[model samples]
Target: MSRVSLQNPIASLEQLAETPSRKDGISEQLEDDLRSFGCELIQSAGILLNLPQVAMATAQVLFQRFFYLASLKDFGIIEIGMGALFLSAKVEESFVRMTYLITVYDHLLRRIQQQSTHTPLDAFSQRAYSLKSMVTTSEMQILKRLGFNVHVQLPYGTMINYLRILGLEEHDTVPKKAWNYLNDALRTHVYTNYTMPTIACGAIWLACRDQQVKLPTTPGGEWWLLFDAQPSEFQNVAAHIQRLYHRKLDRQQLLSHLSDTEATLRNS
Candidate 1:
């Protein structure tokens, strides 16, 4: 019920284009695709590493915030994502060992490449050492870029509290559906753009709409006014989550998209 003073970094699409992360050669579409891809990488790696959902969500927020401060062209998503997850472990107290983290990432990278190399990476090998260094360096870079302010305010708790206040907490399906929406919303940049309360309200709105569970909407102010959300913000959050389902991107898929764009540019 209390507002957290921490806020995530926010930037408009136009502002993002001007940031260091937007190099002259990279297309906005390519960057957007990669953002989604990076978040997916963090989420997948988190799950494989047996990290809690809160850690994964916090990592995604860190990954998203870093990209806003840096450029996709300048950094590899694999490294940054791993760094985010590693740092998030410390922040969230999930405490995954570096060796285990790198091993899972190695496995994930191979899977993404669809490679036949199933040989486990040796912890003493040069490659493992390189990966460890890469992740550590990225963690430092992220800390510096964000000025060591990595506090993230998640919307899950807020959503539940709002539902209870609205007398919808007892509904079996609404809470679960809304929670899923919040999870998917992390794949996009909605967290950076909207406050925690707004995101919570948006998820609730989507869930209620899907279930045909209407809330009180007095003329003086809509139901959302009880929270800190505007009706317009709900549409944007819903659209972001909807677009995530519509466009699925992985490392290889994003590379293909970039290749197609380059080819089209050559013909132009």
Candidate 2:
């Protein structure tokens, strides 16, 4: 029996710095870019597939966690991403058919390539059969590598509850803005490093700052303390989330780099 925990354990800065990819000589920039790419795939594909926010968030977290255990040289990002999305849908009880997943991913890849003449993956094609096998295998690999402890405690519900507690749930734009910030934060490493309360608090802080709305701050302590989040910690979380928007990934270059890496791996 797999022991399901309430949430995945958070890693320290040092542990995060020592990812398998880093140890494999992959540059920090490329690793970060890859993570962002994987998250984008999950988010865009989820939106196209009409998956709920929580389900998409779960897939991104799982995808991040899996790469921490397996290096980019060993596992293809698309395969692990597809597996993560497939497994996450099941985990969140928003079950989507495997065929739909395959089609969506194929469409996304073709769209990225801007190939107008591309055809949908035929169900009986060898490529489709191989991809399905890879997705299932990658799913099992992620489960085993993570010790069957794939539970992710997302900040969405916590953010909502915190907003209600802070009397900001009904405030104009605060709730929606905070929720949007939380969604964007999913693309960053903050999800793996910060606690749920801290993330929720950070999103709220960013939203408040954006809307120029004041949160209760007294000499006694900050309002976020009531939710067990420290001022410095949540502030840093907000900063990390903010920096995510400043990045611009070169998709063609990134794909070429990965291709070169795989060629080297195969030839070696």
Candidate 3:
């Protein structure tokens, strides 16, 4: 429980469009790489620290949300992600000691330094920012950037509910695979732009359809129609996630989506 004065009250949807990350201080490609790297680091750190998947998933959303208001150029990936992971643990009621994340982060730095394809940035190793102080400070910045909106609705709950309704809650295997899909979704923009139920529905839908989990024959409607959400957004979520692993195929799928948008624009 922490209270900080709101930097600015959210007034309109347009305000959400004005993310600081779109400020062009960093190239889009570079920003994507850094953001992806930070997200991966959190996953690795979470595993190393024995933190649960929900903590890492929540941390990923906070990481993505914070960068929208702030800037990657202003904050190093290690600091932003570490702070997000720490704060998320608390927010999700899974308290993690700061020492664990900072320590795992240091280990991640060492691994990155050893990797031949990448080099650790100077800021990555700066002694000044490596300390715990940087994480606590970045936590405040995350709150400020988020306008103090820290209550995130994670897909875990909805995923469970959906799986239960489908009679696969305790059946294991596919549901677990779908759960992994939900965790992996944090790297995509769907979490920030779409509702949790939408993303959850997408994950389960993909697991059943693409991943070969059986569905009941009696249900005639589209699987996503079961949830009260924008099915288009769920499709968007599915596309982005499938793109992460099936880049070659989903890249074309992504282009097809863009191509459709262009065609609609032309008709307009």
Candidate 4:
């Protein structure tokens, strides 16, 4: 649920012995933090470029995969984050100019500095020239790590197709919500852990549950069995989406109550 479907998870000792360097990366917690931040940057770039979620999703996957092979110690996380956005635009065929991208990256870095003034870190991070140089290098490194494997599989498209099959293409209920859910999934390691098809099924199921749309397979055995999907895995996917919604609702409620209290004080 929290991961994208992994491919060939089982590793023979021979393979592990051959690739011992992979073990020399950052700590688990550090990797988690960096991956989360990288996704945030990708989301920011998407907003800045007015790109679609597809691009955002692609960029996030690139960021995740790049870090899987290359260590953050070797390359700046932000550089690869932006580079992923740059590379993903091409992969998704929604190319944004490098200058525009640099501008967005600089803006985000400046914001970080304003939030907490650091020393040379802020100085270097805010430079357009430095960003350009590092991102170009990071992009090459990412491509090399991926072995030029720029293609990414996402549940967004598969989910849409499935919704279309269900005749909910224009319903705005399941498909739309599912689309948002798919985007939300990228914020976590969901893409790295779950299979694309399972993610699609889970999103659709969660959307349907929210919309109160009746499922044909409900009140029965694994609803997705007909589609060759594991119901248990899909349940995990649903749970992830549900958690996102619960967290979102909690924030909204907190904000609403805070605003109401402020209003009361203003009137008093």
TM-scores for all candidates? Answer: 0.88, 0.92, 0.76, 0.73
**Residue 149 displacement in candidate 3 (angstroms):** 2.1
Residues 89-204, candidate 3: write the lDDT tens digits. Answer: 99888878776666677666655545445443334444424446768888888888787687666778888998887787886576877888887787766677777778888888
Off by over 4 Å in 4: 1-30, 115-126, 218-222, 241-268
A best-first ranking of the candidates according to their TM-score comes to: 2, 1, 3, 4
Name the candidate that leads on lDDT: 2
Clash count list over all predictions: 1, 0, 0, 11
lDDT scores in order: 0.83, 0.83, 0.70, 0.68
Candidate 4: deviation at residue 147, Å? 0.6
Instruction: Write candidate 1's Cα lDDT for 1-268 as tens digits.
Output: 9654567666677665565655546666667788788788888889888899999999999988888778776677788888999999999999999999989887876676677868997899776877788789999999999888889889999999999988999998999999999999888888988888888988998899899998877576787888867889887888888887777555565666444423432343
Residue range 1-268, candidate 2, lDDT tens digits: 9656676578766668788888998878888888888888889999988999889999999998887788886887777888999999999999988888877877776676667887788887766666677679889999998888878988888889988888888997999999998888888888888889999999999999999999987566878778998989999999988878888887876777556433533353
lDDT of 3: 0.70
In model 3, the clashing pairs are none
RMSD per candidate (Å) reads: 5.8, 3.0, 10.6, 10.9
Tens-place lDDT digits, model 4, residues 1-268: 5654335122344532332224654444445555666687789878978998888888998877666566555556577887888888988899798878877876676565354653333333435456676678778888898778677877766777777766778885677788888887776656756777888888888888889998665455645765567878887878865655444223343233234323432353
Clashes by residue pair, model 2 = none
Candidate 1 residues lying further than 4 Å off, grouped into runs, are 1-5, 12-14, 218-220, 248-268
